[model samples]
Target chain A: MEKAGIPVVQITAVTPVARMVGSNRVIQGHGIVHPLGDADLPPEEEKELRRQLVQQALEALKREVKS
Target chain B: MRVVHYLNQFFGGVGGEEKAGTSLEVHSGALGPGRVLEQALGEGFQVVQTLVCGDNYAVENMDELSVRVLEMVRSAKADLFVAGPCFNAGRYGVAAGALCAAVQAELGIPAVTAMVPENPGVDLYRQELYIVDSGSNVAAMRDVVARMAHISLKLVRQEPIGRPSEEGYISRGILRDELVERTAAARMADMVLAKANEEPFESELPVTVFPPVPAPPPVRDMSRAIIAVVTDGGLVPLGNPDHIPLSAATIWGSYSVAGIDNLEGGNYEVAHRGYDTRHVLEDPNRLVPLDVLRELERAGVIGKLYEEFLSTSGLGNPLGNSRRLGREMAQKLKGVVDAVILTST
Candidate 1:
């Protein structure tokens, strides 16, 4: 995409697989169910899970190429 | 002398199938079925407080129950927490398991529970806490409570409790040291001899070391680099979802977003079965947040992000999958991107 003038980022609850498949940019999440949190659980838990995942995603974007 | 006892609704004398809907409550005395614990502990150990919460209440309200139980134990001055001989009741077993885990975590006190091997709770909580194997029915109450109390006493007194094998409890994932009768030199010699002769030998010593794998060759330059973003979280389309089987996903697919700003609804979703796909499907951004990466690319932080995103299901996927995926992805991205950033949840 970059060669064609497009920017891309990939987000997933599981970043290991993303890295394995070779995404340009990647993000991590909390769990399999409710990468954020399920509605059955309290709202606070969901928010915290989402916040952590978002923080990790932003950090992935900031990472400089070290190759 | 201070101890806490945990019991399900039936054991707490809250009535059988008739009163299964009973609410959780903490009592100070030997209420309901606590008499068994009281008698087993004898005079030295006292059941200072009894926590009689229903099985459904604890599992359904884990956060609140954890908080409330922690507070109760803190005020009760408990030196140890003992849970139920849950028999075959699955929910009751899980509740006891959760309570024991919470008590150990919050109070830093030793906790013990008894459950039948077939109980689902045994599998989930055994690794987290000590769960002694018990009979499948309530007929084993006397033996179960007595054994649990004996172990609880040893824990409270800081005594050297025997190994899980000898003490008849499930293994707690703790590597316990056992002093065998054989000398170290003799054991090593026997092991080497057995290995040479192709005979079974008991090893008294274990070596803890892992050889490191060679590192990948460094990329030449960043100015003209090809970057690829790979995900194993099974993100795909909802309609004809690209289902990546859990633990054994051999194939991976790439989705094209040539001119799109962000992955919109019906455009991308997760195909991984190991994790729930609702959140990521509801907001595809959760699985692939192109907004932030686009900004980075525009700022020249990276030369250019890869055109396609590689994806597969990662849950329980063996190491072979990792090797295959890494090699395949690396081959595709090597000429295009300077570096790759691998992410796992």
Candidate 2:
């Protein structure tokens, strides 16, 4: 997708793996199974976590990427 | 020994690009490079038949053509099958590899084909056939043919085949159980010693190095940018409406989130088997975060969310498959989506 001129923010718990695979914008997620929402958290808190992660992804989109 | 050869239009003495649409044709004896191949295979081996097809037609109708080619090979009673020293010809390499694999599998004939390492067919069919590395130079046809014939002879005789480097073939990634003088630990120590001494050493295991992808420029205006959420987390509608596989998926689906605000648990399910999907099953938002994205969309944090979520399963996914799908998704999202939030498990 990056090669197609669209910046992509990959949300995964395995940030290093993402970077190694050439994902430019990577945001650390909560876990492997549930990248956005945490299962252990209460529903409201989980939503908050997801919100924060999404916001971070947006922030990642706004920034410049250095090689 | 009766050997059958496959060739593309140009090599088959047919006109070049103009003849690329010509269908399959069978001819007697060796034609063009097949004579070289027959000679390489030695006096006992005769090129009994040659199958020629246009590269475009062969690739465009690979499945049907393969079936027909297999039937022809079966009837020909060929002892060995040889397809091009195709080198870097993409379509020809694919057709050759496919036919070689089919003949070997169906007719119980030893089959050999050759291609350059970068030919797409090398990656697609190297595991199934002995693809001699022809090194992208048509001038080296005799060398490539000799290697292919050598490997084919060994295969026909049920001999233990040599490694890719020794045989001049692309690696099939099959590990052989060999009795060596050095233990793994010893080899590892030697490799470490070599590295420490700034000397060159070949590692036993070859790592697949992905070509670096240049980062696309960041979205200029966040408030007006249209964003799409895509996932390899395998979230799908209940019953897997698009039938996305649980692992090594070849298909992706775009589920309509047009009027929907948040993804409901019962209406959606996880199609991936790589992880414990119980959390995602209970609340699909855990995987895709549609709820949070919806909130952001409404709050004008972004211009809009792409109405559909692009999804595919990533379990046991190969890099080739992922790259193909990513390119397809990129093509689909080119004009509309400004950025993407790709969730992976």
User: Highest DockQ among the candidates is held by which one?
Assistant: 2
Q: Write candidate 1's Cα lDDT for B216-328 as tens digits.
A: 33334433445665666676655434555655787777777567666665666566666556666765645554544554566665466678777777666654345566566
Query: What digit string (tens of lDDT, one per residue) describes model 2 on residues B296-322?
Result: 888999989998899999888877788
- Chain B TM, per prediction: 0.56, 0.82
Q: What is the lDDT of residue B127 in candidate 1?
A: 74
Model 2: how far is B146 from its true place, Å?
1.2
The per-prediction CA RMSD against the true structure, in angstroms, equals 18.6, 4.2
Residue B222 Cα positional deviation in candidate 1, in Å, after optimal superposition: 50
lDDT accuracy of residue B251 in candidate 2: 86
The alpha-carbon RMSD over the true interface for every model, in angstroms, is: 8.5, 0.8
